[model samples]
Target: MRSPVLGAAALFAVVVLSLATASHGALQYGFYKGKCGTKDVETIIQGVVRQRFFSDTKIVAALLRMQFHDCFVRGCDASILLDGPSTEKTALPNFSVFGYDLIDRAKAAVEAACPGVVSCADIIIAATRDAVALAGGLKYQVQLGRRDGMISQASLVNLPAPTITVPQSIQTFRAKGLSTSDMVLLLGGHTVGITRCSVIKDRLYNFRGTGKPDPTLNPNFLQLLRSFACPKIGGDNNMVFLDDPSSSLKVDNSFYKQLLQNKGVLQIDQALALDPATKPIVQQLAANPTQFLTQFNQAMVKLGAVQVLTGTQGQIRKNCRRTN
Candidate 1:
């Protein structure tokens, strides 16, 4: 049999190749070296994230989701952090995305130590890395130098819907220059966080208006889910853990294992196992938690680098919620 070590090395190669093609040249490991004061910016961001994680463990997942939301809509420019009645944060899909206040707090700490040095966009990325680390995920380095965008338009927030199919999800990721493997790996972020029963109720009842649960769902698990206190309609805020309830707060490869068992909470997640293109990758991740974590880190690094504003493209906003 082929060695698992070799398998992982090969997978890492694929990740590097996918990232090398798209990463901008401006991002570097120590982009803030001389700009920030003696206090390392990454250290300040991590300190705040770690402290917040103690008060609310869910903040880790929220920060991760926040990074994804920001990157997907406007290329990781802190656009999702913008404040206004019509900004991206006010978009319907982003209604539940929290952690903006946490970002602000971390930004304030950074500004006190090194004013006008680090960008809120980079702070968001650093906070994401720290949050993942505190939540049991393996650590990975993030390239810096991303500048904050000056605009946040709700009309531009075009992320894929929860009901989308695997093909549709693949296309959505591809539009952002991510590959099939990247899509599967990044979607594993679902391993953390909670979802509202209302967001997933349609899959459990009246799937496609047929008054039947989705056949893809494991029957036993479906019955268990149906028994939850969530109402049949309009209980959008009734939340359920995303992963195995026992380890919902931890970040690992349990999501792939859940997908293998037809316990995925979202239609797109179940579609990962049902679709041939993504199924094998899902299976591999389920079997090798280390490989899953490794790829997840790589995918996140690549995600942070997507269409990022760099150099003279965007400015460092004093306030994340405004352009300044």
Candidate 2:
């Protein structure tokens, strides 16, 4: 355990993708260092995340997923936090996204110390980074200075589907200026989360309309899912861990290991291990859990910098749910 943990911590040093990590023009490692006067804004956010995590262990996954969904659409902005009849929060892909109240809580705490100083966009990134550390993930320095976006429309949401192919996922992430390696590392976030049974039943019962389980699914794993996690009918919304049950709650390479075993609950998860283009990366990460743990931090850092609004491009919202 000690060796593996140390390895993951060193994973960040192994990556040299300067292009993906160049980040936005105005973003910096500690962009908010002196902005809050006497208070450390990130420290404030971390405290909120720690408290919520103690009460809701599942908040780990929710916040992690929140980062992906929020960043993927509209470029790491708090656009996903905007509230309206037609905001991105109302989008179909974001229907299951949680950790909203957690962000709100963190934003409120920061606002109390420095009114209208911290952007909700930065809060989302900071809070999610804190949650990842609390959930056994390597804590990475999240770039700050991201301003909250003024627009968030459901029509603007185009999150990739659960059934997306490995190639398609690579393209999708590439469109956002992320690399294939980044795609593999980012998808690896699923190592700590669970998917609703409704999201994976198609692979279990009628894969490709063949009226049979997906051929790649491990027989034992398939039986386990059908028995209790997901059934042929009903139980559409039941929770099922994305990784093996024993280690689903941990942030490690278990998800990639499970992929090697044909136990991936989602098509995309299994596809990484089986796809020609991504299999090597998956094999490397799976064989070296530490790499998955460590590089994941760098991948997330790159994620936080995606097409972000900086300087005077956006406003600092007093309330994350609306434009200020």
Candidate 3:
């Protein structure tokens, strides 16, 4: 597990998060402050996430990806948390989604301190923010005040596939009210995750049914990838870092830098540097590390507001998996 953020980084993490307002001023920083009566809600959440982060640094990637999966389909609601046969969590896209248990633990901690005070949706956001900072990304604050969603259906899952082209992904994100720039910054989270060979096997073995590797893959990287993952005969599920090996587990601009080298693991990943429309943005982000982290922070906040339920619009679930 990645060690706990320490030294100046921990202090920087505590630096007062900026107050951000949602449409009509629904959400703001510290939304849970004092709501639990002397129990710092975010701090409690941070403690739980920090513990989880210590034991399983993978939670950093899991929680970050969980936020995207939960938000994109149902607008930042915890609909993805509902328990049932046909629920969103049962979808193929969410089959490998982790951190549900982590979120449950965090919610239980909050409930023990102050029952029904914090929203599962807010927990997801806060936990993700904490995870990002632990993984060496920016320590940005997320706006709160969201309520749990009332619906979650596998049929409702429409997340973009890993093979989606740049144009297709641009439209997909646009449909969620995210701009092209936001999509690029958000995808930057690839800086600290992994994808199995099973997910990209076709690109390595057969390109467009031609029985050849993806033309976009650099010849050298192709050999490196085959050696690292996707062996000729077995272990189809072997893990491969999304970013290059040097900075795979750390959140940095290296993912973008690798893209410039034609070393992206996912098709959409490499496409960012190869596509005319997005290549410039990729180059810009690759060159300026600070800008990448800063915009990535803002993009996450934007993602949290997609189609949220606030005020009395949705009930606060005593259990995130079911309605109260």
Candidate 4:
């Protein structure tokens, strides 16, 4: 009964509304805001960090391993946090320090507070965020209810790169459904951590000469770096360092600023600053740390939503480092 133009307009409006609803649903199911509150999970996470289950260095390393795995495959499933000889042999970083001890402490605490309710995977994720907060960034709540992946496929550890190019890193993150904006926001986590020369020595010394130095780094900081350790062609572990000055103990957004200036420690770290697709996001976060934190929390929520094998899919391993 209506005119052709009116009918077409009505159909177009319906399509637009449907797409908008779908988008909103994706964000909500994948990235809804949640409260950390005084929940037992939060308490457990804080308790572990406070008690020092592993040294600050170890915790950060574990978090990086987890982030790498999560972004590589599906989402941040706590597979990297699993412990055991089988898992250890297959681990990406070869089971550096994160083990069942920390997971046991958290499990015990959570059990006492609220038994059999929280997932070990969720604890690891929350604890990582707490660790970030301790290092120097704003604290945000991570959503809970993630289940453990029963089958920890050690072979999957091969996915992450010890050193990655900026474009490759962007492609990896994009493959996981993250946008360039999400990639930069997430890398902001580097703002509070440390990187050993073992990771970036090649980028710093081999390709580029020590005399020139990367112009992005603060001249004074670069001078300090040069004094620490010299790079080599191949070494087990050498002593060279780049540290986040904001709060080495907490996680925050200042890392992006470092990237903007070319102080990013690794190839991938610096790449975020240089990439055309991601540079603007990095700049925006560098300009507004608080907003970055807020968005980072949201991204964490989404990352935690990847194909989780919860409920019956997986069981709580007696030891988090190994499959029981």
Q: Provide the TM-score for each candidate, comma-separated.
A: 0.93, 0.93, 0.92, 0.73
RMSD of every prediction: 3.0, 4.0, 6.0, 8.4
lDDT of 1 by residue, 152-180 (tens): 98999888888988888888999998888
Candidate 3 CA-lDDT value: 0.85
- In candidate 2, what residue range of length 10 has the lowest lDDT sum? 1-10
Q: Whole-model Cα lDDT per candidate?
A: 0.86, 0.85, 0.85, 0.57
Winner by TM-score between candidate 3 and candidate 1: 1
Which residue segments of model 3 deviate by more than 4 Å? 1-25
* Per-residue C-alpha lDDT of model 2 across residues 209-312, encoded as one tens digit per residue: 99988999999999999998887879998999998888877788888899999988889989988988888788888898667867888788889889899989
lDDT of candidate 3 over 156-209, digit per residue (tens): 999999999999999999998887778888999999888888898889898778
State in Å the error of residue 280, model 1: 0.3
lDDT score of residue 226 within candidate 4: 53
Query: Which lDDT tens digits does candidate 4 get at residues 101-140?
Result: 5667877776666555556677677777776666555565
Clashing residue pairs in candidate 2 (N, C-alpha, C atoms within 3 angstroms): 8-290
Runs in model 1 deviating more than 4 A are: 1-8, 11-23
